[model samples]
Target: MRRREFLKGCASLSACSLLFPSFVFAYSGQPLKRYKRAHLVWEDGRPVKAKEIKPEEEYLFFYPFRATPCLLVNTQQKLKGAKLRLEDGKEYIWKGGIGPGRSIVAFVAICTHQLSYPTRERTLISYHPPGKKSSLLERDRVIQCCAHMSAFDPAKGGKVIEGPAKDPLPAVILSEENGKIYAEAVLGRDLFEEFFDVYRRELRKEYGSSKKAKEEVNRCVTTPLRKYTKEVIRC
Candidate 1:
């Protein structure tokens, strides 16, 4: 079956309740959050122009919170909007990619499975463009986590196409004005509280305090995934 059809079937299946018991009937009702608009800037603090972003390249930035990382991508295709279902059973429409060709998209980098994220030292989760081989059999464009081999399809609202991730990656809602991109909000269930609890010491070391780490970001520096993380572990 085609990928789109498969996703549609997934959306309609009652069996999903069994496959994802943690998400079944656990409707929190709240599925989205409007964050302070954050400009995507370069390391020098200059706004990142949408046109300059290379196709299939992955960029990393912080959004909504200082400690939370997001992945930006230019998929080089006009993507289709998707219906994203949250753990709480709430659903929302992801209006698809933005910018020229409707190719630009972004998603929270923390893995939905275990919250593995990109860091200055290493990244267990990273994007693999088409034709690039990873530990997984999938060679298509995917954001994969080596920690547990969870793979999300960036072109499909970060849908989990493989492995243990039961929920979709939270998408970063993006807008463009005068060729520059801005992150306006996040859509889907966020694991911020669990993330904080699990990584408290690391957060404190990086941002001085958990409170500081959770501070809303106004402007975020966008860097290539390679430059942002010293090591990229693909599995």
Candidate 2:
């Protein structure tokens, strides 16, 4: 099936968590994107307290406009010694959520493989560490999607530990202000087709059962090619 059709079917089946990462930019040596977002409050109308997040368990949350699902896992210890490789051959240490013993890190919850969403529903596969007969060590403390068996390390800037995804899960940078954690920026590509696909769905609603109408609705942004490779990936 065509890629678009496959994605549509996945959406219908709620199989949005298959890790089909098409963020494939020839990143042999290049720079990824940098970003900062406005104040994003919790959908539940309360600050996520550090005390509530148990060790090695995940806390799921949504963002502005409910555009995407973000996965937060607290390791009870600060995430340390993880490598963050930028597209531009730069590397850095990411202590996601400050220091050890209160380390809570968030990642783009959409599976990079197919831009699929992982859930606690039937798709839920309990976390299994390495050395298990069927374990995929890409490491522990991960956000896993059973759909395509894609896994990502939430503590390590969403790096693909093991899966078909070529790129890391786009890091949703978080910051603490006035004693509350807020997503400050996205330090990589946009969630696959988030707004663009929304427009496509809206167009379908506007022009039901009309192929010509669907064809007539032009997309504002096609998948764009990078203009410059030397741009800096902000931390």
Candidate 3:
């Protein structure tokens, strides 16, 4: 009787649709088109004139549209943002779209899990992959989303240190002139909206028409690799 009951329970479990992996997302191979240099604007659309944040702190701003939120942070070293093949036989830190130097950094705040954005406070705890020892090459800090517990290393070009998330959060390339910072363009795939690519195609033709401007916008990037196991790349 117990064996028969166990077989019936197994059949019931097989009929369940709810599961951990609702779906898996892959990289879109299209050339990045969104994000052109523009005046820094506040959430209310007023032009910003000066610095509003201090070191190790972040200030949130919205531009291009309300649905997109960007983050500007002050980090110690901008060296680990993204590893890019900028020169002969060597990869350089691509600013991951943010400007060079450790003074300030900017990136889109959209989380990779379900495309939900994490809060501004430094609330995520540090993490290490199972059975793997920590190293200096790994990121020192991680920004976590409580929704799914995925963590992104802000210093390492917003790479996903822990997951269900398979991609890094897209970056908002920034430029600083005199004493003010501006949102230039976005890097990487959109986390939540599938229609963003369509919108970028039209926006690109309008803003990034010039070849020189297009090249300038294209150089900085972070390439996230696909790994089905825990031995994932850190930078």
Candidate topping lDDT: 1
lDDT of 3 by residue, 1-235 (tens): 3434544665454343221111100112222334445566544444444345444334555543443445665554545446433112333233543344543556666665565542223322222322333353343444555456667666776666677776766666565567556665555554424424434553355456333223332122211111111232232
Compared with the true structure, all predictions reach lDDT values of 0.82, 0.48, 0.46
Question: Who is ahead in TM-score, 1 or 3?
Answer: 1
Off by over 4 Å in 2: 1-44, 86-95, 99-102, 119-139, 194-235
| Better structure of 2 and 3 per lDDT | 2
Identify the runs in model 1 with alpha carbons over 4 angstroms from their true place: 1-30
Output candidate 3 Cα RMSD. Answer: 20.7
lDDT of 1 by residue, 28-142 (tens): 2336677887899999978999887887578999989999999998887789778777666777676677886667899999999989999899999998875676656547578
- After superposition, the stretches of candidate 3 with alpha carbons farther than 4 Å from their true spots are 1-31, 41-52, 84-93, 96-100, 118-140, 195-235
Q: What TM-score, to 2 decimals, does candidate 3 have?
A: 0.51
Local distance difference test, candidate 2: 0.48
